[model samples]
Target: MAGMAAKMILGNKLNSVKGELGNLAGGEGEGNDKDEEEAALIEEARQQQEEERKARHAKMEAEREVERQRIREKYGLKKKVAEEAGMPEPDDAGRITRKKKTPAEMQQALQQQEDEEEGFMDTVKGFVAPFAEKLGLDLFK
Candidate 1:
């Protein structure tokens, strides 16, 4: 009698434990599904943004081409070499081209630039020296 009652109680407890464990596992599976759905949404948004950027870039390039064509037609200008067009070559980056010089010429240019820099530095040192001395600073040291 007492043994039978104890057996029934143990069986009920075992069944309850099993049910709780099953619920926990189901919860984890639902969480994984939600995570997958969120990841898909993020990837879709990124792809859409990339498509928009490409479209804008292509549109700008097309507009530039149209403007160039218009200018060429209006001026009746043909693409010609700079020398044949009687114009100096255009350096797009605005760098000036100079003829290569002999070693003596290079040394003279370097000396001139050094002299200019020295004069500027002397003026700055003159102004800063007094303040530095007032603060007990020794610039030469």
Candidate 2:
């Protein structure tokens, strides 16, 4: 309840561009330079958008470089060598990376692994059973 409301408020605050300009709400329907002003406003929005995009790109590049450095240090690697080692790309910090498998797929994979392990265990028991029987040494004994 409270948490969800807080998250909704936070998410809205993060995703909005309302604070970029003042009095956007003030000029609702009518405008001074209807066509020209709209065009200019659109251009301004585009320019602001571009600047934000470039800033975000620069920030991401810096963070990625930092992470790459961290990965290299953690793995005891040099930059050139780590670049060549072909590590997987990391997703953004907040995003989930794994694909969601369908229930059928999940069950199939789980059953397959279970079957393999069971088969191996059965084989081992089968091999030992004859020796155990000859020595009057059943598993229950």
Candidate 3:
């Protein structure tokens, strides 16, 4: 009879542990549901942001169109047909009137700018060097 009582106590303890494990697994399912809900909310927020951006872009476009129309009206500029403009209808016919700088010229300009900046920096550094030295600060190092 004592042996039977021991077996019954062990069985009851095992069933209680199994029930706890099942509850833990069920809690994981609830966590997954919460994660899904959070993901959905994030997606919704992204959609709302996209809609707001589009609305802002449309508003800006409308405002720009209105401004352009007002400028045209103020200047008394009439829309001319392609033939009335007395130019080639296609934009490819436009010529580059101004000459572009060559690579060597561009490099020379950049070097000149760098030299000027270096000279200015040197002047500032020289003025600050004595103060820095007095403070025992080796700024150059």
Candidate 4:
């Protein structure tokens, strides 16, 4: 009796395996066609949603750009121009153009910056001198 039960279980398993192999070999009849149709429909729906998202994004970007231009105009701000040929064009004649600094002007600016830095360092040394003396660090020295 036990042997007969085991044989029955093995036969059922073998039959199921054969069925799976037949399906893998393209013998699934009408069910495979229905599955393929469903997959194609799903793919089509995904593509449509992607296209709609891209369109919506583009529309939002255009609206944002328009709003930015409106804000700039309200604030009397010039529209930013991209540099063409390594030079930016002025939006209007009334806009002030910056002149290149002469060698003398550049030298003066550098000297002024150095003096300011030295002054800052002197101020810091004055503030830290007492602490340095207490700790015997002699930082300035």
Task: Pick the lDDT winner.
Answer: 4
All predictions: root-mean-square deviation over Cα? Answer: 16.2, 18.5, 16.1, 15.3
TM-score of 4: 0.42
lDDT of each: 0.87, 0.81, 0.87, 0.89
Off by more than 4 A, model 1: 1-26, 76-141
Backbone clash count, each prediction separately: 0, 0, 0, 0
List residue ranges in candidate 2 displaced over 4 A. 1-32, 81-141
Question: Which is better, 1 or 3, measured by TM-score?
Answer: 3
Task: Give the runs in model 3 whose Cα sits over 4 Å from its true position.
Answer: 1-26, 78-91, 95-141
lDDT of 3 at 72: 86
What TM-scores do the predictions have?
0.37, 0.33, 0.40, 0.42
Q: Model 4: runs farther than 4 Å from truth?
A: 1-27, 84-141
Clashes of 1: 0
**How many pairs in model 3 have backbone atoms within 3 A of each other, for residues 3 or more apart or on separate chains, i.e. clashes?**
0
Q: List the residue pairs that clash in candidate 3.
A: none
| Cα lDDT over the full model 1 | 0.87
> Model 3, range 1-141, lDDT digits (tens) per residue?
999999999999999999899888777679789999999999999999999999999999999989988888999976545645776443544666744565889999999999999999999999999999999999977
Model 1 is weakest, by summed lDDT over 10 consecutive residues, at: 88-97
